[model samples]
Target: MTQRPVSNPAPANNPAPAYNPALSGNPQSATGRAYPNGNPDLGYNPPGVRNTDSAVPLRRDKPVIHNYACKDAAPGNLAFRWTYGSNVAAKNRDPRVQVVQYNEDSFVLRQNVCVHWEAPFTYLLFGNKGALLIDSGATADAQHYPLRATVDAIITRWAQARGRRAVPLTIALTSGEDVAQNQGLVQFAGRPETTIVPKPLHVMKRFYGLANWPSGTGAIDLGDRVIEVIPTPGTHQDGVSFYDPYCDFLFTGDLLFPGKINIGNDRDFVASLERLKAFAADRPVKWLLGGHIEMMFVPGKYYPRFATYKPYERVLEMLPAVIDEAIQYARDVQGKDMMLIRPDFALFNGVSPDQRTQVWPVGVPNINAPRPF
Candidate 1:
C-alpha cells in the first residue's frame, strides 16, 4: 500500500514509537515504526512475563500533536467545556449537528462540538443492505442536536450516492446503559425502518452469539461489512469494542478513548487490553477510533472532565498499541493503588481523592457493574 499522506504526530517524552515496516516487507516501512525489528526488544509477552534483555514495548504510533486545544483562552470559564473551541454559531451555521463524510460508505456524526465536550461520536458504516449506527450522543432533544434528522440526511446521502437506493440504519450502543451513547435512543425509537439492539446484557450476549463473557467472541455481518464484537468489559462491565475489518477501524467505545480511563474491574480491564492486543495482531488495522477524544494537543496532556471544547487536540485516530501500553501499565502496577498516567490516557478505578469510586468487582460479574461517577 502506498504511504498515507497525513501529518505525523508531534513529539513528547516517551511518546509512542513509530510503526515498524519490517513486517510490511519494505525496509522503509520501518520508517514509521516506533522501534526497529532487529532491536531484540519488541515481542509478544503476556502479563507478568518480562523480556529481561528487551525494552518495555510502549504504544506504537501514538499520535503526537503540537499544542493544547485551549492555549489561546485568556481566562475565566470560557476555556472550560461551557464555551471553547470552534464557534458553532459563528456566522449562520447551526450548532445542532455536524456530519462529516469520511468517505462515500463511512460517515461520522457528532453532537455540536459545543453541545457537550463528551459529545460522544456516532459512526455510520454503510453496507449492501443497510448501515450500522454505533453509539448515540449525550443529548436527547432534537432541537439541541437533531439526532434523527441528521441520520435521515445520512441515509438520503447514502441512497443518492448508490443510485437512489435507501440504506436503513440499525442502531446499536457501544455499550448498554451508557448515558452518553444512549441518550438519543428515545429520538430514534419511534422511527420506521430502525431496529435498536436490545440493551439487556443477556439479550445482547445471545444476540451476538457470545456464549460466555471474556472468552466468547462474536460478529455481525452488515451484508458485506463484517464487525467483530470483542468483549471489552473494563470501562464498564457491558462495554465491548467493535472491530470493523472492512475499514480497519476498531471502535473501542470507552475501553480506550482520548480521555481518562475509568476502570471497573482491573483484572477484566487488563484482560480486555490483552485481548484487544491479540485481536489487533491477527488483523490489518488502520485506525483504532474510540468514541471520544480527550487527549489535549500536547503529549500526555488532557482536558479536565466535562471541559467541552478542545481547540488543540490529538487526532481522532489512535494507535492499536495503546492497548499494549495500557496492559503493560496495568501489569507494572498491579494493586498499587496508583492509577497509571500515559501520554494518551490515564487509568483508574474511577476512584480519586474525594469522590467515591465504584467497588471494583472480583471476577467478571454480570453487566450490572456500577460506574465510577
Candidate 2:
C-alpha cells in the first residue's frame, strides 16, 4: 500500500489566528507580537539555569535507501537556488540601518542591499555591553560585489552606534557554507579584529580548509553582553544555535523556521531539532532569529500556551511524527521497487555513494519505503 505524507493536525478551537493583514503584511507594526521588536515582557529568560556536560549523540544510523528520487534532486532542488540577486555589488552603496527593539536591550538591525531576496540582510545586534552579529547573510560572492560592500557599510554603522572606532563584534554561523560564513568573513577581514564562532571543526575544515575553527560550548564576552553557543548538530555536524543571555534571544540557524524546518540535510535536520529542544528547556528563548525570515514566534496572549508553541518547541514536538512519516515513505517506495527520500536523508543511511554520483544508494532493505500518513 502506498503511504501518505503525515500532516500536522491543526490546533483545536484555538485554531491559529486568522491571517491578519497587519501582522502578515506589516509584521514590524504588529503590536504585542513577539520578535524583531514587539513586547518586552514576552521575551524569555530562564530564572535559574545550570549547565550539564551531556553531549549530543554521535552514533550513526545504517543506510536505508538506494535509488531514491529525492536524493537525486539535490543539484536541482529549487530550495537551494539563489534566485535572489547578488549582494556584492549593492554593498558599494551607502548603508541604511533599521532597528526593531525586542526588549530593553535586544534589537535586530536590518541593513538593506540589492540582493535577489526582498528581505534585507539582517544583523541581530544586542546592547548588553558589547555587540553580537548572528548570521551575516551573503558577503563574498564575486557576483554579489554589492553584498560585500553593504556588509562593510553595516559594520561601520555598528561601530558608530557603539560609540567606538574598534568595537569588537562576534560573528556566529549556523553552518559552514560560503554563503552563510566564508563570504561574510572575507568581507569583514579588513575591519578591526572580530571573533567568529564556527562549530564542528570538521565542516570548517572541509568547506573552508581551516583546521582550527572555534568549537565547544562557551560564553562570548562582548564587553557588556554575553552570547552563548548551544551546539545543535544535525543540519551539519557543526550546526549550532546561539543565545544572547542579556537580550533573551535565540538564533536558530536553519534548524527551525516559522512554517517548517528546512530538511535539506535530513539526518542533522532531525538531530538539530532535538538539540534545540534541550537548549530551549534549559534556557528560555524569547525571540527566534531565523536565516530567511528575519524573526519568528508563536502568537497568543497566554504566556504558557505561547511558550508551548514557540517555533523550536513546536518543531521538536512534531519531529517524531515527521520521522515516522519519512520511514513510512521509505516502506511504500520499497513496495514499488522505487525510492524517494530527501537528499539530506541519505547522510545517515550507511551506504557510501560518491558525493558526485547522481545514483541513489540502491538495494538497501525497504530503501524506497513510502512516507507515513
Candidate 3:
C-alpha cells in the first residue's frame, strides 16, 4: 500500500546499503541513473569539466650530467681600501696584519706599518689541492706580526668552508734576500703540512723548477690554479716575480713598486723589466702588485725610510704601462748610480739598498704629529 510492495525491507535499526559506482565499474551512473558529481573514491574526473590549474610537463628521462670539475679562473675586484699605518701612540688599535679578500679564493695581506715600516703586502691564493703564500712579510716576531698563525687560521677557515678537515700551505717569496720580505720566514718554521720554499737563491730556483733561472719560467700548481714564476733578480739577487693568469696580475715584489726601487743589479733589473714587458705584451696584464708602497699620492714624492704613518700613501696596484716607463728609466740610468724620481715609482741605482728620497729629521716619522704631505 504505502511502498507499493517492498522488495527488500530493512530492519528498524539496520540501514540500507549505499550506492557504489566503483563496484559497478561505471562512475557516471549509479546502477542505471547518472550521477551529478563524479565519484571521488573511484578516481573519476567529471565529464566536460577540464581542470583549470596550470601544470608543467614532465621532464625528459635522461642521465643528467653533473659537473664536479673546477671552473676556469674567474675575475675578481680590488677596489677596496687598504689598512694604512696610524700613530705609534695608538698602535694598539691597529691589527698586526690587514687581510683583504680580493676574491673568495684569493687574499691580500699587509703588515702593519707600525709593526715594520716597510708594510709589505703578501698574497694568499687557494687551489683545490693546497694554498700558495707569496710572501711572509717584514716582521719575524710572531708576537708582533703573527704571520704564521694568521695564515694558518686563514687556511683552516678556507678548508672548513669547503667541507675539508685541513689544507696544506706552501710559502714562497719574491725576494729571499730582502729582509723586509723574508724576515717572517722563520715564523713558518716547523709548521705541519706546510712547505716553505727555501729562502736561498739556488734552493728557491730549484723548488720552482727554475733550472735556467733568470731566463726560463717556473710554475706552482695549486690543484687547478697555477702560479707562474718569473726570474726577476734586479731588486735583489734572489728577486722573483709571480704571474697569476687567473687574475691577470703580475706580482713584481720590489722589482716594480709604487715607492723606491733599490736596484741590486742594474743589468739584471733592466733585463727583467724587458722580460716582463714582453710577457705583458702578449698576455692580458690587469695589475702589477708589489710588496710595498713608499710613494705618496703625489708624483715623484715618497715617504722617508722607516716612516710609519703614511696617510696619503699611493695605491698598491701599478699598470703594465708603468713597465714601459720603467724600461725608459732603467735605460737612462743604466750606467749611473743615482736616484731617479717618477710618478709611479722611484729608481735607486748604485745606491744604498735601504735609501729613501725623503729624509726624516729624527730618522723616523714623528707619530704624534701629522705626516708632512
Candidate 4:
C-alpha cells in the first residue's frame, strides 16, 4: 500500500479545489508562477518589483483566508489593516526592504523582488531605549539588500518621531542560522551600536542562557519591550523562535511558514512544537506571524520553486490554533511511520550531515554563499 498525506477533517481554511500535490511542491511547481489576478500592474517583475493592492478586493469566491484561520475572531488591535499597494515603482527606485509600518513602533521589512526570490521577511521592532531587527535578507551585499540603510532610515524617522536620537539596534535570526536569512552580516560590520546575535551554537547558548545546546530558552530586550527566544534547532542546527510580548504575537521564522518546511532534525522540530505549546499556555497569543508564505490562489496551491516573484501570495499571518494542529499532526504522523506531510506544515525526514548545507537547484547563491560575518 502507498503511504498517504494526512490532513485535518475540518476542511482547509482556503477555498477548495481540495489538495493537489502535483501543483504544490514537485520541484517545478514548488516555485511555479502565481500571477496577480486583479491587476497586472502589481506583478513582481524584477526591475519593477511587483505588489498587490492593499485593498486587493480579492475575488468573491476567494474570501480572505485569514478571516477563516480562527472562528472566535482576532484579538483587540491585533489586526493587519494594512494594504499592500502596487509594485510598479522603477527598478532603480526599488530597495531591498519593502518597509511597511505595521504598528506604532513595529515595522515589517519584506525582501524586494530585486533581492533573493525567496523574498524572505525581516522585522524591525522599536521600544524606548533600542530596537530589534529580525533576520537579514538573502544577501549581505549592500548593493543588493541594503538592509542597514533601511534600518538607519527607520531609526532616524523613529528618533525624530519621539524627539530623540537613534538607539542601538540588535540583529537577530529565527531558530538561528538558516542561510536564506543571513546575507546582511557584512553590511553592518563597523556599526558600533548594532549588536548582532552570533549564529554559532556556543555563542547562541551563551546569548540565550541556554546551558542546553539544542533546546534552551532566553529573553531578548528591546528597550522597554521583552521578547522570548526559544531554541528550535530542527529546522536548522541553531534554529530559534522569537515571541513579541506587547502585541501577543510570535515571530517564527521558517519554522511556521506557509511554504515548504524542510526539517533538518526530526526530534528537534517536534520538541520545538511542544515547547511552543507550553509557552502559549501562559501568554495570550493573538496572531502567529511566520517568515514565508508560498501558497497561492487555492488551498495547498504553492508558487513555483526558487522563483523571486510571488504575485498570488496568501495572508502572512496564521491563527495560534494552527500550532496545536501542527503539534498534533507532527505527533500523529511520527507514531505511525517515518515522515509524513501534515496539513499546515511538513514533518520533513531527517537528512545526513553533509546534506545539511546543501539546498536544491544546486549552487544557489543564498544557499551556498560564504558568510564571513
Pick the winner on lDDT between candidates 1 and 4: 1
TM-score of each: 0.69, 0.45, 0.75, 0.68
**Which candidate number has the best lDDT?**
3
lDDT tens digits by residue: candidate 2, 229-268: 6666544556666666554556665554322222344444
Error of 1 at 280 (Å): 1.1
The 0-to-1 C-alpha lDDT of every candidate, in the order given, reads 0.65, 0.41, 0.76, 0.63
* Model 1 alpha-carbon drift over 4 Å, by segment: 1-94, 353-373
State in Å the error of residue 240, model 1.
1.1
User: Clashes per prediction?
Assistant: 15, 42, 0, 17
Give the residue spans of candidate 3 off by over 4 A: 1-73, 89-92, 353-373
TM-score of structure candidate 3: 0.75
Report lDDT (Cα) of residue 169, candidate 2: 64
lDDT of 1 by residue, 1-373 (tens): 1122234443476443454545422223433233322332222322244322122222223311211122222121112231234433333243566667775467777675566657678888776667788988988887777888888887875565344444567888878867888888888977877888888888888888888786778876666666788989876778888877666778988888877777777888888988888888888777777887776655555566665446666667787777777787777656656555566776766466123234432332223222213
Query: Candidate 3, residues 6-58: lDDT per residue as tens digits?
Result: 24545569644454644423322344223322232222222244321111011
- Report how far off residue 191 is in candidate 1 (Å): 1.8
Candidate with better lDDT, 2 vs 3: 3
